[model samples]
Target: MTYGEFWVHYLRAHQRTGTRALHYTGSVLALALVAAAAISGDWWLLPAAVVVGYGLAWIGHFAVEGNRPATFGHPVWSLVSDYRMLLLWLTGRLGPHLVRAAEER
Candidate 1:
């Protein structure tokens, strides 16, 4: 699927509070890793961060959230969505989606 399509689904999957938390943690991991890589000038640290961060997130999705991660099907888009959701959460807009979903349910 195109990244755009995957983004839509990714956002939907993240509507849940727990799922959003996982995304936030993953974003923080990725950002921290990148920052470390930049500061230490160790390129390899970037990949390590990506793996560790995403690994924790996938585990959270499966074990805690009881859902398959969209990353399995759309890695790039999932990453983009992770950042987008992170921004939304940080900006206090994430709850709107949750509220809307709850209303639908």
Candidate 2:
């Protein structure tokens, strides 16, 4: 699959059945925040981004998704996919239907 396809699958993998969709949401949020901070050259936001980003992600993993993160298994791929997904999301193209296409595969 392409990078775009990987991102959609990544999101789907994080979605839970009934509880809040915090894992994917948190991961997306953190990625966007970090990208914004990095682009703005705010060094302070760097630390905050790291803390908040991972904190939110962990919360989602342990609390919401209830599964080990793919990051643990595929660190580099997961990191690259996170940024790619964040860009896709920020561009307003990360809709449910589009990402849902990934599930079909």
Candidate 3:
């Protein structure tokens, strides 16, 4: 699927508030790790960021969402969409995405 198509699927996969919350938490922690790595020059933290971020998200996908992640097919777009979704959630603008996702379903 194209990025736009994958985004719609991503939104639907993350329809649950709990899943979104986990993703947000993971994204925030990943960002912090990146900043920390930059500040302390601990390059290892960069890999840790991927582990911490995708780990939590995958748990939510398997346990909460009961589905495979969109990343399996579209890794780059899925990663970008994760941050976009997190940004929208932080800005209190995720409701519209959720509505649109539900409509698609």
TM, every model: 0.79, 0.54, 0.95
Model 2, span 10-88: residue lDDT tens: 6765555321244346566666777888799876776776666666666776777677766776677776755655566
In candidate 3, the residue pairs with backbone N, CA or C atoms under 3 Å apart (3 or more residues apart, or in different chains) clash, namely none
Number of the predicted model whose lDDT against the real structure is largest: 3
Residue 98 Cα positional deviation in candidate 2, in Å, after optimal superposition: 5.1
In candidate 3, what are the lDDT values of residues 1-105, reduced to their tens digit?
677788888999998888888888888999999999999999999999999999999989999999998889888898999999998987999899889978987
Instruction: Report the Cα lDDT for residue 80, model 2.
Output: 72
Q: Can you give the lDDT of residue 45 in candidate 2?
A: 72
lDDT of each: 0.76, 0.62, 0.90
For model 2, the stretches where C-alpha displacement exceeds 4 angstroms are 1-8, 16-49, 96-98
The root-mean-square deviation over C-alpha atoms between each candidate and the true structure, in angstroms, is: 2.5, 4.7, 0.9
RMSD versus native structure for model 2 = 4.7
How many residue pairs collide in each prediction?
0, 0, 0
Better of 2 and 3 by TM-score: 3
- Give the residue spans of candidate 3 off by over 4 A: none
CA shift of 96, model 1, Å: 1.7
lDDT at position 49, candidate 2: 65
